[model samples]
Every structure is written in C-alpha cells, then in structure tokens.
Target: MASNEVVVDGEVVHCIGCGAAVQTIDKNMIGYTPESALKKGLENGEVYCQRCFRLRHYNEIAPVSLSDDDFLKLLTKIASTDSLIVYVVDIFDVNGSMIPGLHRFVGDNPVLLVGNKLDVLPASLKKNKVKDWLRQRANAAGIRPIDVELISAKTNFDIDRLLDQIEKYRKGKDVYVVGVTNVGKSTLINSIVRQSTGIKELITTSRFPGTTLDRIDIPLDDGKLLVDTPGIIQPEQMAHHLVGKELKLVTPQKTIKPKVYQLNPEQTLFFGGVARFDYNSGDKKHGFTVYAENNLYIHRTKLVNADAFYASHVGNLLTPPSEENKTNFPPLEMHEFKTTRKSDVVIEGLGWVTVPADVVVSGWAPKGVSVLIRPAMI
Candidate 1:
C-alpha cells in the first residue's frame, strides 16, 4: 500500500514522475524498466521507470508519441478539478506553443501565464513591454491569465520571483502546470523542486515533447500538490519534423545573436530549407534580423535562383532536414504578408525574422507549419 510498492497482478504500477504504467517490456515505450531493475525497485520500494531514470541520471530523454485525442482527454481531466492553472509557453514560438481552446478546459479556474525562455530574447528588450505583449497575445487567444510572469527555466532567470508569484496565487489550491511540448515545463518544475524542496532534478526535463506522459504530482508544504502534465504535442511544431541532430541545429540552446541581413527587393534567405524568407517588394536596401539558434545556417541568395539553389543544395549548403528527412520534408509553402508596421515573420517552431516597416515579405515553411506576421517581440 506504500507509494513505491508494486502490488503484483492486482494493480499496475506507474512511474512516480510520468505516471505511465511501469512494465518490463518494450524499451521504446513510455514507461519501461528492465525486468531486473523492476524486481530491484519492487524489493527496495523505490522506483523511477527507465525513462525517468535516464532523464534523472544521464539527462537524456526518450520521445513518446501520443494522439491529439489522448491529449484532449488529459486536458478534459483538469476541467473537472478545482485547481489553479499555470500555463507555460515558449516566447519564441508563441503561436505554435499556444493550446487552442485552453479557456474551455480550465473552466472558472484562474490561469497564470509563465513565458519560458526569456533569456533567449535580446537583453536590451524591456521586461514590462515583453509581459504586455504576452498579455495581449494571451488575451487574443482567450487565455486571460490572472498574472503573466517571464522566466528562463534553462538559465534559472526570474525563477525565485516566479515561485513567489505562484505561491501567492495558488492560495492552497492544487496547481496544474500545463503547456505544449518543448516549452520548458519540466525544466521549470525541476528548478522549483530544487529550490523549494532541496530535491535536485526530481522531474525529467528534456527538449522532446511528451516527456511527461501522465500527470506527476509533487507535494507542497500546504498539503496541496503541484502537478506537471504531459506536454500537448502540436503537429504544427517544426520539432516534429526534425531529428535529434537536426533539431539541435534549429533550437536555440543559449541567448541568440541576431543575424542581420541587408536585402534588396528581390533577395531570399533560406533557414536550412526548414524555413525561408523572401523580401519580395521591400525597399532596395532594408535590414532583416534573424533571431534563431546561433549555429543554424543562414544562406543568402538571389530570389530568381532561389528555387534552383534549394534544389541543388538542400542537404549541403542549406543543412538540416539533413538528407535523411529530405524525402519526408514537405516542400516549403509560401505565405505573403505586407507589413505596415515593424514586425516579425514567425515560422512556427523555427525562429522569426524582424523586418523593417512597409516591407512586402513572403515567409515559407514545410506544409502544416504556421507562418504568420506578429508585432515584433524584440
């Protein structure tokens, strides 16, 4: 009856961190421990399913795939509970990271929006302005959180203040931290656990989506719990289309150094074939600054030869999608926008390009990925 025991055949044991059914088979599955390890855990009365074990010990994560229907079912559970919702989002990919219809799921519960990866933004960017932007975007999406806080889980920036804010708003009610995948929810929780309980790296944190399969509850001092939910996997995320190495090439691991490009009316830039930006009808000389992974390859080319260049150099000059995913990679779909004001052309899951006002630009990404223009976040 203890928390760690596996009551053989009577009931299935679940991972303490991810809440997946612990089994000794299928290493590829969500909650898998070897037979010997399972037996040892059963005898010792302490267990972390293999996924959590790797995540804890080796800082590695195994990807688990889930259907949208399954994710919706998980969200539906939160609606029936009287808990405070902490909605975490990636500041870099605001549109792609938002869970559509989240307001419906949380019911009357007050939501707190936590923008993760604030450290990725330019240091010159004002925090209050960023928070205001987040609030406006969240309101437009029907998520009017009681408070909006910004933090970088990777860098531990503003974490202490964020914890204080969460404590104030929670008011002894249970807290549910939810987000779409790759938003740093697990990393944020891991930081909180370390700070609050002195338990180092208690939860699995990874760049992959669905790292936390089911809800994992961490007990708070007030007898309430802070639950970490599985990241809702959005198909529109460019992370889904990329492999490990390819993903690394695109995902920012540290503060980005914005790359500035001087463009003419008919210039094009390719972000490794994953995303492309064409300055179709801009001024003869204008600037486009890209904020993305520091190492992501950016190649400039004439607009007329852009197609031929891409066809010839997809895996070489334009790197990731890396030959392995070339066949599966959807041809870039173009979406044109004429920016009346200074804006960022965001290719969901990839990064954004800040363009000067009154530029006619065409942003492209693989089919199904979102390409939109939004007020510049920088």
Candidate 2:
C-alpha cells in the first residue's frame, strides 16, 4: 500500500478522473471500481477507478445520476465565490443549450458566452452575422454576456482567441465553465487543457448527457484554475429521450450537408421518428432545407398517410429510437407555426428546417421536446 493511500471501511478512494469518491459496490452509481481492480491499483500505485478506466479505454460515458437539487446546490457555490463564468452553448441547438435561472446563480460575475460547434454550420454562412444573431438570442433569454465568442471545439477553430479572451477577462480569478448537457463543455475544456498544458483527453466526453459528474480543476499558468462543472440535465432536450446510438444519429459530427426538399401543401417529411414536418398550407412549392446529421434517414409521404407511415415504419424504416426504446418514447406532439417571413423551425437538439416566407407549417416531436421558430441562421 502507498503512504498516500487512505482506505476507509466504506468509501475507499477518490477517482482520478472526475475526483468522485470511489467504492466497490453499486455498479449503477458514480465512481464504481471493482474490488479486484482497486486491489491491483493499490499494489501498483496506479488508480483510475472504473468510470475513468472505461472512458479512457473504450470511450464510453456513464450518466451521473444527479438530482436537480444536488445540481443546483453545486451551482449555488459559484454565487458565493468570485469567478469568471464561461457559459458554453451549442451553436446548432442554441435554445436547448441554455441553462435556466443561470443569472441568479452567477451573481455579478461577467460571463463569457462561448458558442460551440460552429463547424456544424454551413461553410457559406458569414461568421459576423452568426455572432450578432447569437448575441441577440442570448440577450432575449435575459443573459447579457460580456463577450460572445464562436468556436468549434471539435475542429479547434478560434481556440487561441478564446483563451486570450479568458486571460484578459478573468483578472486573476478562477474561471468556472458551465452549461446544460450535450453542449460540448467537456470538449471545449479538453481542448483548452491540451493547448495550455499539453495534456490530451483529460476529461471524458461523449454525445450523451452527464459525462461530467463533479467539478474538476486544472491549474493555469498564473496559479489561477480553470474549473469544469457538471452539466445540468434539461428535461426538454431531445437527448434525454434518446438512447446512445439514437443520440449519435441526431447529433451532427461534421458539417451538415443541407438537404433541400421542395414541397407543396399536404406533403410531409419524416426525420426518422425523432421529428416530422408537414407543409400544411402554402401557395406554391417552397424549398425546405434540412440541416441535420448527414446519415439520418429521411422519408417523404403524404400528410394524410403520415400517421400510418410512422406507425408501421418506426422501428424498421424510421429507427434510432428503435424498437427497444419504443416504450419510453412519448407520442409525438404537434406544434403549428405560421411563418410571416423566412425562418427556421427548430426541433431542439435534433436539427432545424428552413422554410420560405408566407407558409403554414407544423412540426412534431416526442413529448417534452422543444419545438421553436427563429430567424434563419444560415
């Protein structure tokens, strides 16, 4: 046994991954290390705990079963301390990425809004225009950030600029990075860590929610720290209803190749069972451009036969929330929107459909998912 090893009867050790107390029982719980693994780790003076082991070797993520009360308690700690809040958001799913009541928890700290996943947008889109649009949306949500930076953590885009901004705004205080689940907070932190400390894959990351269970701090050059906080699970995000593989189908891994579908009134488009769109009323054929995962299966049908098509094809043709997840899947709810001008009908966490001016369209998603309309982002 090592001199630093402190072994208690019940709680034995802390995981090197996310710094959670490790135990040998409860396979479903956080920081579960097998008894044999713990013994081996103690003998060799190398301990990774089970969660960190799986994340490093298999690239798998385990959900941190944290209650809302527990998560809010963690956020409340930030309010008492002086820190710079780095609020990261998914550029593709802006509405779904917002943390509710965040202003109350951040006190008067200046927040730097980081819009991630910028690589998922179309290449032709202007960067300045997108930044302006994000600023307006964040302001509307009652979040007034000191600066809004657009970056793609997956592609390493504009990371240097973000780091420079952090150095300038942090003013020797600790930086706390926070966001709702699946917003690339871990990915962004990992990138920053790799650049600053030459440490690769320090944190576990995946498309699923709750990969980070507790706060992990990385020391900065000036003795300040960059803290990564656990992501809050928003019930409205489609990621909550989806299985792991189903989530990958909805989350875009690369730049979306916009698929244009020309439709007349009474036509429908099904994005698997995740989302459905109907052109209920329109004067003529309008172009509907879909910005979603490149490999997601899309089917077209008559509006009248849409129900029957979904019923028969859900598990087979329209998969992802496949047959195994059918019981958990909620019945799709309908939301009708009349577009006075060009806009995007966004199915939060899935993707969006750009519709032309003067059209009546209806969007459907599983219950609890958010369906909203916003000015066209492209």
C-alpha lDDT (0 to 100) for residue 174 of candidate 2: 98
What is candidate 2's local distance difference test score? 0.85
TM-score to native of every candidate shown: 0.92, 0.93
How does model 2 score by TM-score? 0.93
Candidate number with greatest lDDT: 2
* 317-373: candidate 1 lDDT, tens digit per residue: 798988878888888899999988999998877788999898899999989889988
**Model 2 segments more than 4 A misplaced:** 1-13, 25-28, 35-46, 59-65
Residue 234 accuracy (lDDT) in model 2: 86
What lDDT does candidate 2 reach at residue 289? 96
